[model samples]
Target: MGDIRRRWTVTARARSDRGPNGLSLLPWLLMGMGALSHLIQGDAPNPVIGGLGLFTFNTLYIAIVVRAFSPCHRETPLTWGLLTALAALTFALAIGYGREWLLLFPLLGLAVGAVVRRRKRLGRITVPLVLAVGVVTFWRDGWNSFGVVYGTFISVMVTAAILALDETVRQLRATREELARTAVEKERLRFSRDLHDLLGHTLSVVVVKSEAARRLAPHDIDAALAQVADIESVGRQALTEIREAVTGYREGSLATELDRARDALSSGGIEPVVRQSGPPLEPRTEALLSWVVRESATNTLRHSGATRCEIKVGGTPERVRLTVTDNGRGGDAATAGSGLKGLRERVAAAGGTLDSGPAPRGGFRVTAELPVETQASQEWETTG
Candidate 1:
C-alpha cells in the first residue's frame, strides 16, 4: 500500500509539472486509429503508398504539436513549414480515403490552434481552413460529414482560449512577485533614511553639548552641570526616537525639531533665528519639514563656520515653503551629502521639491516646498 501511494503521488506531481505541453495533445492521435485499421485490414487501395503517407502524416503531427508548446519555437518558419506540410498530407489522405481518414481534419485544427496565439491571426488561418474542410467533406462524404467541420472549429477555438488564459495567469504571477520585491526595497530605503537623519542630528547635538560642558567645567561648575544635564536629556530622547525608528513608527514634529535646533545652535556658539508664519500645517507636512530642519541645523553646526543661521517657514493653506540660510563661507549643506540626497528623494516621493546650494549673498542655503495635501499624506492620515 505504501509503494502504491508513493507511485500515485509521483504521478500526480509529474502531471502538474508538465503543465500545458505536447503530451496533452498526444491522446488525440488515437483518432487516427481508424485509418490505421484500414491499412491493417488491407482495404486501402495503394497499401505501400497509404502506409508511407500515414507514417509521414503522423511524423509531421508530432513535430508541430511538440514545437507548439515552446514559445520560442512555436512561431518559427520551421514550425509553420511543418504545419503547412502536415495540412497538405492531411488533405491528401482525407480526399483519397474519405471514410476513416476524414478525422485528420480536426487534428489539423488542433495543431493550427496550438501554434496561432493572437485571435485575429487565428481567425485569419482557421476560418478559411474550416471552409476548406466543409467543402472537402461535402465532396467526399456529403452533408453527413458536418460533424468533422464542427469538431474542427471547436478544436481550434477551445485550445486557443485555454492556452491564452494560462499564459495570462503566468504573466500575472510574475508581475505580482516583481511588485513584492519592489516594496521590500522601498521599505529598506525608508529605514536607512530615517536612521541617517535621526543619528546625524542626535550625535551632533551630543558632541556640541559635550564641548560646551568641557569648556565651562573650569570656570563654572553649575553651568557645566547644566550642560551635562541637557546632554542626559538629549540622550534619553534619542533612545526613545531610535526605538520608534526601529519599529518604523516614528513621526516628526516641526516644533520639537526647531527647539532642539535652537539648543544645538546655541551650544555651538552660533546665533539661531527661526520664524514661522502660515495656516496650521498638516502633520505630514510638519514631519517632512522637521527632517529638513534637523538636517539643515546639523550641517550648519558642523560645516558652516557661520556665527548666525536663519530658518524660516511660510506659505499659504495650499502650499508650504521652508528656507535655511547661514552666513558662514557657504559650502556645506549644498554639497552632495547622503543626508541631503536621501532627504531629497523622500521629499520628492511626497510630491515636493528641495533645493540646496550657495545663497546669493554669501552663505549656504537649503529650501523646500510642498503642497498642503498629498496622496501619500492622505493615506497615512487615513490609516493612522
Candidate 2:
C-alpha cells in the first residue's frame, strides 16, 4: 500500500511538471463563436422575444460546453433545467415566426449531447427527442425544407462526434498514467529489494559474530580474537556490497545465498536445513530465488525466535517453486514488513506469485512460484 501511494504521488508530480500548457480554453472560444453567429444572422419577428431567446440560448450553450469539458461526466439538476428552458424557448420562436428559427434546435441537440449525464440514456432519450423536435417543427414545409433537415442532422452528428473524440482522448490519457505508475512502482521495488538483501545479510552475520566474540572473550582469548577478526571482515564486505547495491550493480545467485543463509543461521545458533530437487534454472530465476532466501533468512534472524529453518526448492517442466519455513514464533503474515512487500512486487513483475502465512503446523512460511516459460519471467531471469 505504501508502494502504491508512492506511485500515485510520482504520477501527480509528473502531471504537475507539465504545467499550464496542458490545457487551453481555445476550443470553448471557437464553440462560442459558432453559437453567437446564429444570433446575429438569425431572423427575429418580435425583436424582444428573439433577442431574449438568443441571449438565453447563448448563456445555456456556454454552460453546457463548460460542463462537457469537466472531469465528471454526470449532469446536475441545474443542467437539466437549463436544457428544458432552452428547448421551450426554441419551440416558441419556431412556432411564432418561421421554421428558420427551428435551426436553433440543432444548437439544443449539441447542448444535449454535451450536457447529458449518461451515454446509454443519452442515446435512448436525447437522439430521439432531438429528431422528433426537428420533424415536428418542419413537418408543414414538407420535403422542400432540406436546409432545416440538413442543418439539424449536421449539428447533432458533429457535436456527438466531438464529444466521443474527447472521451476517447481522456481514456487514452488515463491508460498512459497507469502505465507510468506501474513503471515507477517496479523501479522502487527493485531498489528496495537490492538494499534489503545486501544490508540484511551483512548485518545478520555481523551481529552473530559479535555475539560469539563476546561469549568467548574469557574462555579462550585466541577464539575470541578470531571471532573479532571475522566480524571485522564481514563488516568490510558488507560495506562493499552496500556500495554495489546503491550503484545498482549487485547481483545474487540462489546457490550463493543458500550457502550464506546456512552460515548466518549456524552463527546465530539455529539449525539450517536446505533441500533442492529442480531442473537447472535460468539465471533470472536463480537471482530472484536468491533474494527470497536472503530476505527470509534476515526475517528469521531478526524477528522469528526459531531454533530451525528449512529452505526448499523444486521444479517441474512447467514451473519452479521455492519455499522458506521456520519453527519460529509466527505473527500475522498479512502485515509483513517492507522486505516481504518488496519481494512480492519483484515476484509479480516476473510473472510469479508469492504467498506467506502461518505454516500449517507452526511458525511462518513463504513460498514463490514462477512459470518456466513466460515472457516476463524470461526477461526477469535475463536482466534480474
Best by lDDT: 1
| lDDT (10s digit) by residue, model 2, range 298-338 | 88888888899998887676788988899998777423568
Query: Tens digit of lDDT per residue, candidate 1, span 1-384?
Result: 999999999999766654788988989988899999999999999979888998998889999999999989999999999999999999999999988899989999889988997989998999999999999999999988999999999999988888878877767877997999999998888888888888888998899999999999999999999999999999899999988988888889887888889889999999998887776677888999999999999999888888999988876667889999999888654453699889888889889999998999999999999988633222111000
- Provide the TM-score for each candidate, comma-separated: 0.86, 0.65
Clashing pairs in 2: 284-381
| Cα lDDT, model 1, residue 75 | 96
* Candidate 2 local Cα displacement, residue 353, angstroms: 6.4
How accurate locally is residue 128 in candidate 1, as Cα lDDT from 0 to 100? 94
